[model samples]
Target: MYEDFASTLAATMWTDFDETPEREGPTAEITDIDSFVIDGNFPWTIITLETDQGVTGIGEAYPSPGVHEIVTDYLRPVLVGENPLDVERLYNLMRESLSGRGSQWGVGTIAISGVEIALWDAAGKILDQPIYQLLGGKTRDEVRVYADCHAGEAMVSSAEEGQEETTYEPEAYARAARLAVEDGFDAVKFDLDVPSGRDIDTLSRHFDPPEIEHKRSVVEAVTEEVGDDAEVAVDLHWNFSPETAERLCEAIEPYDLAWVEDPLPPENTDAMRELKRSTNVTLLTGENRYGRHGFRDLIEEQAVDFLAPDVPKTGGIAETKKIADMAEAYYQALIPHNIGSPVATVATAHVGATVPNFVALEYHAREVPWWDDLVARDDPLIQNGRLTVPDGPGLGIELDWDVVDEHRKTRS
Candidate 1:
């Protein structure tokens, strides 16, 4: 299917290029590409693409190791000297050039995703338009966001020493949900894979009866605490077997969760389909998946209720829009999984605004106090748990290089 789509798209591009007249002056070309790793709740890999025309665009890769290296060492070669305005062409170029590597998935796609976002940003600025306008047009002025509340209190990264671990008590979950609701989020999510009191074998991926009851207690407490104030979702982090996932889904069916995310591992579509059939809970998983091809089976089989592709990890702006288009055909909602800085968040918003089936974008940095500080905008990017799609050129936000430098992680 993708091959046919690519062939059609290539033919269209060739026709468009053939009809175009030759330009007189110098064209905007990519001059250099650089990447940085910032130490936040996670190590965020940020990329910057500079054009010969003096327009520089910024982007963020999903938090992961070696993303910066992949960007500088691999993707940079294909991107430099190319026209950043030809975003789709350049994106395909990057992928095809790295076919021998892991470009189809993993850190390879992650690095390319960041550079691809930077290309769009640069292209938007070069064309004096917002990314949504470039894609098609806006479906709405604002994009809804869901707060990723994690567990009790704010979670401290494991890199931070001498910090107390998050509590897993049901009351703690309730308190966290209440806090998110009071902070003006209409929707919230928490981790359901936290440690339960009883565990016979952690590696077995099977939940004992007592463990199931404990998870149920947490879900019940959170729902009861929030009541009608907010909708809730839970993330299992792909830590359970299909049988355990079915049991967990059945136990929480009465709580009216918005969705159960990544209940089982992402690779097994057959198992995911079976689990979805056996339960009434809404299922959403795609953050681990990459690009439109990565989500083909999940959408075609109707394995889950929602598609949650992480923009930076999946395939950046243009690629995610393609993924969303595919989901729309199947009547699925696009709730992007976001864990990067404001760069990726706003980029995802641009795509969200253009897609009709966009439900909401995830805001995973509520715990990162300086998250908003990373952007150089006068107003906060997120207000009342929603993002107003930027009308300014490109991604509609600028980076505070000073803040970026402060948070940058130094490698030995």
Candidate 2:
């Protein structure tokens, strides 16, 4: 099925190089390619590359419409005849091709992310090694995973095991926290900004008094409910001003929350730094950051205590590792924001295995019942709320084609 699809987009991507005898040697030329946009928690654009040697590597770009065109129209022509094992060389092409045109963020990074990851996957297979070995080696047998359980989604609030619905009361948060705790997760994150009805309305400079109290209740409920069983974190999603964020951070300081994520939008690091100074709460940020260059200042200034780059969105394996390494130098942890499918999750895990500063990878699809079915595995991919880094090869997971086709979005 993949071969047939690859044959169509790949016919021209694979330029016949019989004329260029000097350019020969160990080239695992790309033979076929296909991309899928599956509608899940977010629109996930997944890419697959088939080599002349019958090795098909899977990769994913963070959700973007331009990724399809970039992969097919821009990158295919340059990458088809190139050696898949020349991971660094191919990655340079992905970057330099758009150098003068600015390929650091948006569609540029997303496109490069897909191509760069596929190159690494192919390189791992050709070397007969796990992706982690290719990156360096394992730092841990399993990567700790944190569940993003919140009341904004269907959850277990009552005795009925399968019951699920969105409710944002303090008790609702407590129920969600208990649900995550019972499932063997020792670390949990909750969306604290949305529960207060006044948040979106009072966007100017500060939160109303009632709003502050409501937000505090949500945090305390989750922390009190989970107690010592699990460490708790809250995500602001950049919905607060520095003044408001400062107050909120001070309010939640006594609860012992793991960190306050993106209390304000990252447009101004100075403001974020001020927020950092204002609170005792650890700051975790940069899920929307694109590449290593985008993270340099964040790491250099020590604006945040943890860097959470979404794997697929933050330039895939190499770039994310670079960002993680940068954060490590500043004694910051790289937790990695993730809302992607199994492919991206495991790809991030291989990275999690290598980075010394890796804290825990996020598992955000607790509500998607078919999330596990997307991968071909006999046992569960996630065990006790942690993902055991697979030694198989590449990302160490295969997409369940039947399941993907069913949820695939028609546009891409």
Query: Residue-wise lDDT of candidate 1 within 27-108, one digit each (tens)?
Result: 6888889888888877888899999989998888887788766666666655667778778777776776567677899988
Candidate 2 lDDT over 168-246, as tens digits, reads 7787778777877888889999887775654356547468778888899888988889999999999888888888888
The CA lDDT of each predicted structure is 0.85, 0.80
Q: Which is the leading candidate under TM-score?
A: 1
Stretches of model 2 off by over 4 angstroms after superposition: 1-26, 100-102, 154-166, 198-200
Model 1 local distance difference test score: 0.85
Error of 2 at 158 (Å): 12
| Number of clashes found in candidate 1 | 0
TM-scores vs. true structure, each candidate: 0.91, 0.90
- The count of backbone overlaps in candidate 2 is 1
